[model samples]
Target chain A: MITIKDLRKTYDGFEALKGVSFSIREGEFYGLLGPNGAGKTTTISIMSSILKPDSGEVLLNGKNIYTHSDESKRIMGVVPQEIALYNELTAYENLTFWGGLYAVTPSELKARIDEVLKLFGLYERRNDKVTAYSGGMKRRINIAAALLHRPRILFMDEPTVGIDPQSRNLIFEVIEKLHNEGMTIVYTTHYMEEAERFCDRIGIIDNGQIIAEGTLDELKKNSHARETVVVNFNNLNDALLQKIHSFGSDFKQVDNMIYYYTNNLQTELSKIISQCNDAGGEIHNIEIRKVNLETVFLDLTGKQLRD
Target chain B: MIKLALKDLRLFVKDKRSMLITFAIPIALITLFALAFGGAGNSGKDAKISLQLSDLDHTEASASAIQIFDSLKNVNVLKVTLEQAQEKIKNGDEACVLIIQKGFSDSLTAGKELPLELQYDEAQEMQVGLLQQSLIPTVAMLPFNIGNAKAVMRNRFDNMVKGSDDSVHTQIHKESDGLFDALAMGVMQGSGTADIGAGFFGGDIKMTKLVAAKKDNTLGLVQAVAGTAVMMLLFSVVGIGVGLLDEKQEGTLKRLLYTPMNPINILLGKMLSANVISIFQLIIMFLFAAIAFGLDIYSHLTGLIITILATAYACSAFGVVLASFAKSRQQVQGLSTLIILVMSAIGGSMMPIFFMPSFMQKMAVLSVNYWSIQGFYDVFWRNLPATGGTFLSRIFVLILIGTLLNSLAVMMFKKNILKLS
Candidate 1:
């Protein structure tokens, strides 16, 4: 188990983290979800042992990490947002070098590299320079480089940002595999669906504090059981959108589709239908589904997941 | 530690800029210098004299004087009837004019001495007094040698020219090495070589053929080239440091910091790779210099290697220091330009240190260039034993400084990384 007690981080008199505390248990896929500048990066950085906390005790298995940093750092693998592989080197070469830094012998590095490359489907492109790789390819290499030493704990920050759907799926698949294989992962991102689907427990942080932290099902059950409905309407312009918005405050139109969130789904549906009929708009198929993690997040934070 | 160092080496090789600066630039500069300056062959150096011979006495005695002047190497013997010589003397072209004033062979046989005038262009002549003093013995020793050789004539030629202490009337033909020969002699002998005919222009003394050049010219040539290499090689350190700055800007350095590796080890790996790159650059330069300039770098290679190693360490340390100080690649580029330009200029990279001002020399001592250049001079010009040792010690001191600077840089870098995170 990893525990952070009263963690504080400041930069030149501006508080980034103000006495926040959290703990991640063993064999748990924990998500640290926050917007930009919410101290997500700082929190993770401190946890990864790259940056020291101002006033905190990071205890790993009852041992204070600050007092025994060398041992603590050795157990964690960090997959940074930025692709950190050396561009001038081949992916395999970068892996070889990073592994060596971790005290892995050449023969060991070679064998492990082969395994990881095959796992990521990067074995065919192993000899290509990182600079010559696609954005997705580089991202895979970055994650693979981190996994070379097989750390007991894995920390990934925005690991799937800006990649294609195929790449995104591949990354999520790998994360799933790692979690099932008993690697305790501390993942941070702004993506709610990814957190909803993947994280065993979620920590929704805002303004340097974790406002909500629990399993997805538990958080949803604890909150009002509301279903977010997708009404994909057609050609409903601005004047019509304003008239329709009067039906519910939690409603936004994107292209032809209107997404609305409400706890009183039966009443909210009647209001939407009446507004559509009065506006002389044809109502499309109303797909009814259970409230997802995004709706749960919207109810809690009052913001969209994509935003 | 060794494994980590090797890992750093792998990372270093992954960087193209590091390889380019340390290997490419030094060898290029060395080759450029070898071509621009003397490689193995000094270009067409021979005897040259600026003289004005005015024959006032056009009789047999003066004619013989003119004949000796004509026989000298590259000597422009002007046969002006004493009138034209006067105009040239004021023009500052001629250093000295040999004047045969109304002297005949009859006066020498009758034992009556006549004055021989040597008019000099005082403005053009830097060492007129020395030249005048030298002319005395040369003019008198001429006919004495002829007289001594003709023993059948049974004449004592002991009393050659009778004149005052400062001024002597000529009684013999002359022999003298002009200014170019003197300068060449100064340069050659000043370098401390054991050779005879290097300055010999026969009067009565024969050319001493006993001495031979001990230090091979090829090895000396290579040593000179090494000086140029040392000057340009310092810039390579800037390249390595800049690589660090680039990593920082790109956020890779921050990522690396997240690794379990020691921050100290990280700095160490970089510095070690930088040193290796510098050494490799110098080696390539020497190898090419040997092939192109016929410079025998193989002879004093151990000495050269030490100097190279020391220089590399200094540069690596300097680069790390620069990287820590720099916040961006732009900052690194701007700062590297300032550092490399200043060091190269003060350290005598563009020219020889001897040509640099004494104050500049004082400043240069603070640079790796000064020690490197001095070591090169010892190897190339003097070819003296322990020149390499002297260079090696200075280089070791530089390496020590480099190590200290690198440590400081690592500390600074750690702080910077934390801030960035």
Candidate 2:
């Protein structure tokens, strides 16, 4: 479990983290979702004791990480956005080095290295230098290195960024397995789908603030934006669009497509299709979906997730 | 910390380019300097001074003088005509020329003054001095021969008149004949050339004696090896520093800080690796020199080991400080290259410090290489016994300065690198 209280960090004349705060329960996979320069890495850095925040306290099980750095950090592992591995060293060697720094015993260290190398499917190339590995393989080894210490909590910052889909799936599966095994994980990424699929709770951060934080359904329920229903027509006219707009104020029509945002998609679908038929337009298809994190983020921050 | 250092060392060892830069290049340079500066195996031969001789006198006395020059172990006499001798001296082919006058033997036998001509080029002052000193005793012995011949003849005539016996008269006359040949031989050979005429020409003709120093050539060999080795050690340390910068850029340094290890421990680990590698580099170089060239590095065992430790630590600390100040790997490389090369050149790595101008030699004291090379020289070349005075001063200064620099580097790393990032 981790608690970040009133974290504020400044660089030069700019404020990177403006009094952001959050917490993660044990055995929960929490994802900090944000775009580039949204200060997710900064928050992770401060919480992991890699960087000291200007005015904040990161408590690991009720111990301030900065004040009790070693004791607090002993139970944590961090996988940075970058590879953060020695290209000249083999995967096995890199694991051994990281494990050794955690003060793992020789026997335990060897066992852990073997386990992680096997887990990451890098056992076949364990002896090869990291420089000779593929990007996906390197990312796998990077995660494996963080796992060598068997920490209670793992902080992975954009672990699957720029990696192949296969590697990304492999990483997702690993994180799923770890979460199922009751491991506390704090995953950060800008990929809304990944956060939706993998994270138990998602925190949407923007401009150094946690703008939204909740489960997928909770976020959707909490956001004021309604579910969108998109109806495509073979032929659409302005009169029919106005009639559809009369059903709800939150409506827009573009080309042969009409969008309707309502609290109830099922109740609004039939009336919208009947109105389109009355206008002599044949309905092509209808799509009904709840608002996702991207919409929640956009509605809350007035910016796209990728922005 | 030890684990971190070992990991860094393993990484460096695994990288072929790093190994080449740290070890292979330095070894090649050591071998080159050894070969160029006479650091190969001892051949058990003292350096010889060459002399050009023109025997225009052609008499038995002059012939005997030429034979004396030929028989001397430290002098190599080359036979040349007067014109050839003059040409050789003008062209710097010969250090000096010795020409025997036409009436030299006649003048000597008549007990009259005779001066043989010695010609040399003024530009070759050192060679000219050595040749002049070598010839002094040979020239002074000429005047002593007349008095010795007169004494021997007087002894023979007194023995015949006193009626000592027919055998006594014969013995005295034979002894006088032997004395004349002995005197002729002495007059041709220089002092210290024949122990038979020891002190015979003392204080005569302001005769100069050559004092051979047993340490000069060996000192030169050690300086060449030590200077180059220290210079290359700096470059390798800079390489390690650049490696630190790379790790920092890649986020490994920050990741390490996230562990239970202290920031000081992280830097100390890197410093330890650099120091260990540098020390090993020096050991390999010294061992190669000793095995291949018979350099007596182990003669002062304590001094050599201590010098290696102090110098390695100091250079490694310097590298860490440089890395701490740099923001990128390329910046570290460019900055360290210029600084290390300048320090090495000024500190006597590319050439002997003594050969530099006096001000440059004084400035050399500021460089780590200067202190390291001087310490090695004290141990290997001067054979200063490894006592406290000779090398310990250098060791003390190195350790003190290294500690200060390393502390600064650690502080800078914690402030500028970790906290700022």
lDDT of 1 by residue, B27-95 (tens): 655653453344622332312344567776667765776676566544546677556665544322234
Which pairs of residues have clashing backbones in candidate 2? none
Best prediction by DockQ: 2
DockQ list for all candidates: 0.47, 0.55
All candidates: CA RMSD (Å): 14.5, 14.1
Q: Candidate 1: which stretches are off by over 4 Å? A: A103-108, A223-261, A272-290, B1-224, B387-393
lDDT of 1: 0.68
Q: Over the stretch A1-307, how does candidate 1's per-residue lDDT look in tens digits?
A: 9998888988898788887788999999999887677788889888877778888878899998767887887788889888887899998899998777686778888999999999888999999999999898888888998899889999998898888888888888999999999999999877877887889998877667777778998888876537767677765777778777665557656567776667788887777667777876677767665776776776666666556
Where in model 2 is the C-alpha error above 4 Å?
A229-289, B1-212, B216-219
In the predicted model 1, the residue pairs found to clash are none
For candidate 2, the per-residue lDDT at B7 reads 100
